[model samples]
Target: MELSFKGMTALVTGAAGGIGRATVGVLAGQGSRVWALDRVGLEQEGVEVLTGDLRGGVLLEEAIARAGRVDVAVLNAGICRPAELEQTTAANWDETIAVNLSAVFHHLQRLAGVMKKQRGGSIVITASTNSFDGEAGLIAYNASKAGLLGIVHTAANELGPYGVRVNAVCPGLIETPLTREAFDRPEVIQPYFAALPLGRGGQPEEVARAIAFLASDWASYVTGATLFVDGGQMAAKFGTWTEEKAEFAGGRWRLKPEP
Candidate 1:
């Protein structure tokens, strides 16, 4: 089935690269006028790139105002600076919250008003698997992501009456420029590969597809929900059984008792 947003306008943050960039492309492909926001500028067909600091909230507000009638809002801007909890400074923690959580809250607050005026709209926030699971050296990142879910739930409840839907997309280990170095290192990505039921990482477009679905009428009934685009990583975490691997064959890890 084809999803169309022919007359819709979408506001996408972090549009320069990664899943944000992919979501902008996807929305534009569906004929939605996209307002792409990021710290650095991005130039793409069918996209009006807006460059600014999300922390300041000025750019975000400007983008929302410029959209005029935003049918969909994708909150995808975030930063992950890895530092052990003990080594994490107040400055580090504040910066993370400013960009990841505060910025999102501000955007949602403004978008909620616009959508309320329009009488309806969908808001999709890009959360992380860390929102559920704790990572060793990412205390700030983890906390910010977890806080995002609270925003999603609260916003959904408040906006529901106005026909505005709010949801989050929690992505697993998706390969993106931000993660390129770590993804290229076997030591960094091998464990995720083994734990993921899909036996591999995900692509930005994979998560972007989920965002588009939530933003579109296809998920009209869905709100206050989180769609996991983790290639089964979360499922693997809770699965009762696992497929045993026999031996490496045909340049692949062969499963025992193959179905």
Candidate 2:
């Protein structure tokens, strides 16, 4: 593969996981001095692992100090829980938003300050296919991801003039620790795996490559876009009438997706 970031610097949040780790490895391989920030222990050779919470002010500062200048910021660190709407509590909602959406805002607030002076930068947020289609038991995950796109669009437009590009990558059922348990759960992901058109889940590196391209100057004109990396899952058709949320020309309140 070609090295697109030989002299650039990158900051990858959640570098201990699948997408983040793959990103860290790929960027570092391409000669970018990477600060792989995560809350978990990452024993990688080329990475400078900063283990801390992204929502914590101090850790963010420390990571920036270590990175010196952030040219590419890939906000890939996020958590999810399968709590139904009724079981979702205020605390869970707040934490989910904090880690997923608020933390992205926090990172952007700081990165904008740095990049504004540096004159330009790139930001890639790891959103989810959940943003496109709703899941019954993952209200918090779904809502927070949807909020991430709002941030992406607003930031892209607001920061476009500054030469900074902001975009979102929505991955569908990628292979990661986050989805491992669910996929392994005989009661859950196994049965639904067939519902996916590709007949298999995607690897984390697949998502990482797309994010790498978006963060590079190769995508100089790409911003404010949400790229769906699912294997045709979003196009699934759902059956007959479900209760509508609002009256539309299609006689449906919301979209009915099939698998």
Candidate 3:
């Protein structure tokens, strides 16, 4: 399926981050006029950058008004605070929920209204595999991500009548700045990626491509769906790689060479 966005306008939040940056590049390369929003300022050719916090909802409104019409909206802004339930601070929990879940809700509400009037649009959310699993050391992050499904399902249901589609991409162990520390440590990824069928972590561009597809016309019939951009990690409950058949090196796992 050809994912062409020629003459369309796309808005991406968290534009400075890994997945968000990649999504902006994908949309722009596919011929869409892209507007990127984030707390940090961004400088990219042919892209409009909106700098501000997602919590306020003002920047979101500004992007919409300036773009004139949003054919696609990638609600990719989020924060992950890793702390065990006992250690998770109230401030951290509130902040994580505000950015990851609350911001999305406000943005989706505004986007829905705009798209409903236009009678067509697509909204792709940045959910995570943690949405389904209770990963240790991420009490707040997991909860916030899990809450996104409620938003995705409800939005998709209500927006379908207005010709607007809502969906989510759940990425697992992607090599983004948020995960750079984990990827840098061989000890961390060796055991973690061993559970994945691909034996490696995914890149930002890979997730971006998924987001682009869901935003594009190729997914016209797909809505209220949660697309897993994970490397078979969710499917492998017990993991597939083993030391007898595979070797861990270079921050990834690989099948051992035959003698």
Candidate 4:
């Protein structure tokens, strides 16, 4: 009924907002000495909170130094603003990749150094459902999240030898304060709900629990896996009679109801 991570040291990115804040609260409540790292304001009692962009320089260095050692590092920082493929300019794509992909790498590199010195740690990255399911307008978001799978896999293979485990959590539509307004919009959530098999989005804490599991001793042997927390979005089937293109007996295909 209770999960304990007492005395552990954790660095959580994107801690000023939604899922990150939820994770910080969950971990802190469970006894982990949490460093709530973010690029914006975050005030919490009994937590060594720091505000800074994880991209580069003094901010990251100072945070790591302050922590002394990190037993868990979560790269939960990412950005997504819906932009169509053709309409997605170079700047748009670059920003998404920078924050969602490049930022993860930056944090990983720094934290891995600290963890390796301490001889071990767990690294959880926040990927998204869009990584696997195609979202028409958010092309850059899709690519950035999908890239985390590769990063986790490669890191697991490389870091496993050092007792460091790397994994990713691909969250579905989570109902966070930031999404509350957008999802509350009839012009938005109405149509979105139709596609959600559960007919509702998930909460940030729901995803946070999964991250904790992966980062805890219970998952000591788990690594290089993408755990989807979507509301069956990845498995939802088209109403019926969807077409499938395949190389059958002689490189031909047919349109039929999938068995």
Question: TM-score winner among the candidates?
Answer: 3
Q: Which ten contiguous residues of candidate 4 have the minimum total lDDT?
A: 245-254
Question: Counting only residues 3 or more apart in sequence or on different chains, how many pairs clash (N, Cα, C under 3 Å) in candidate 1?
Answer: 0
Candidate with best lDDT: 3
TM-score of 1: 0.92
How do the residues 1-259 of candidate 3 rate in per-residue lDDT, one tens digit apiece?
Answer: 5679999999999999999999999999999999999999888999999998889899988998899999999999998878899999999999999999999999999999999999999999999999999889999999999999999999999999999999999999999989999999888898999899999999999999999999999999999999999999889988889999998887788898998
Give lDDT tens digits, candidate 2, residues 102-167. Answer: 888988888888887888999999999998788898999899999998999999988999999999
lDDT of 3: 0.94
lDDT of 4 by residue, 1-259 (tens): 4567898998888888889999998888888999888889788887887776767645667877888888988889888878889999999999989989988887788777877788899999999988787979999989999898889999999888889999999988787765777656655654455455655568899999999989888898998988888766677775211124222221112244455
TM-score of 2: 0.87
Model 4 residue 45 lDDT?
Answer: 84
TM-score each candidate. 0.92, 0.87, 0.98, 0.87
Clash pairs, candidate 4, are: none
Give candidate 1's error at residue 86 in angstroms. Answer: 0.5
User: Model 1, which residues run further than 4 Å from truth?
Assistant: 238-259
Comparison by TM-score, 1 against 2, better one = 1
